[model samples]
Target: WQLFTKPLPQPQSKSQNRQGGEQIVLLGLAAMAGALILAIYASGATALYNYSYKAGLMLLSLITLALLYWSLERLVRSPWGRILKAIREDEQVAKALGKNVFWYKLQALMLGGAIAGIAGAFYAWNLTTVYPSNFEPIITFNSWTIVVLGGAGNNAGTILGAIIFWAYNSITRFVLPTEIIKDASLGAFRIMSIGLILMVLMIWRPQGILGKKEELTLGQ
Candidate 1:
């Protein structure tokens, strides 16, 4: 208990350790490389194989998502990633272990903001125009729903959750309108469905599909 309470010793050689800036730079470089490959493939695939433009764009988006997921997975497995987890679990614990918790939190925010920026840029490109109306308050709730359905700390689960969510959206858009609900109440029904699903999940499996019980931090 005393040892845990005491501040941990700092490393003697700071230069030997990987810095946050270096990690960010590497992530940026990886994104750039992935973008370059995507551009080359998009052009060649469309021109040579006669793939539809929309198909090519979809392929590019999938490739970009894969690259981002891979990069993030790598980062999460690194020592610095462990520290981030520690901070998430308990900032005071991380501070006691000699980590600059505030700095790590800032880095996390920066990384998240960058990823959101990339997604926004891709969305604008896909739609060919951006509208303030596109980003409704419901969008934030939907994101939270994805996280909850997928489980926090599980990247693959998040991806799967997204796929499921879109599938649900498709059904609501096409089938529900014709078969079940009136158009006026469809939006309310959709939100209600999501809420019910969340309630069921919370009751039966709060940790989510791919989440471990130990990794569950709902109340914490």
Candidate 2:
């Protein structure tokens, strides 16, 4: 929908608009085909009951992480990445410089969405099931925490942030006085601790552990 509306040139006539719509449809179909292929391959591999799913999952995850990291690193170091940074800092300035801000933004959104979809697919494979309840609003918040803790716009930082967040959760689960507090209350306390830690981090270093202060727009 964003591709159809935001990035493309405004069509002056009905025929031109139809053509644009057709392009989006074609792209969507291609994406779906790729997804189908991946699904089939994963299903076949995991279907073998004797096969170790954990080993396969771990190997696949490492490969995916490497590819994603390499791709993002290369992109961010290119000239196009400078434009993206400019757009993020000031869209109006990017527009004034004759850059297609809308198109760049749309591209960023599409890239992010695609990566997220891949991650979701992997998550489903790990769980061996896909259910509506699997997705919750807290998932988004947790992602935000990781991003903020790691340092915005820094891929390595984001990865480290996620590790730290999960490590904290694991530690708390085992270290907390579960006998004193009910299981439900303990869960709430764990969440509150994370929130408190985030608040402290925000106050001390709004740019995150690895982030440069100049790169942040906190005061602005």
Best by TM-score: 2
The positional error of residue 139 in candidate 1, measured at the CA in angstroms, is: 0.6
Whole-model lDDT per candidate: 0.62, 0.62
TM per candidate: 0.74, 0.75
Off by over 4 Å in 2: 1-51, 174-177, 218-220
The local lDDT score (0 to 100) that residue 185 gets in candidate 2 is: 84
RMSD of 1: 9.8
Model 1's number of clashes is 0
Tell me each candidate's RMSD, in Å, in order: 9.8, 9.9
Q: Tens digit of lDDT per residue, candidate 1, span 1-220?
A: 4533554345354332323332342233333333333344444546766555545566666677778789888988999787876655555566778776556655766886686667666665555577999879886666666656776566766666665665686578666645466888888888999999999998998877776676654224
lDDT tens per residue, model 2, 1-220:
5654454344354332212111222222222223333443455567777345545665666677667767777877887777777665655556678877667656666776677777777777766888999778876667777767877567766666766776686667766677777777877888898899899999999878776677565113
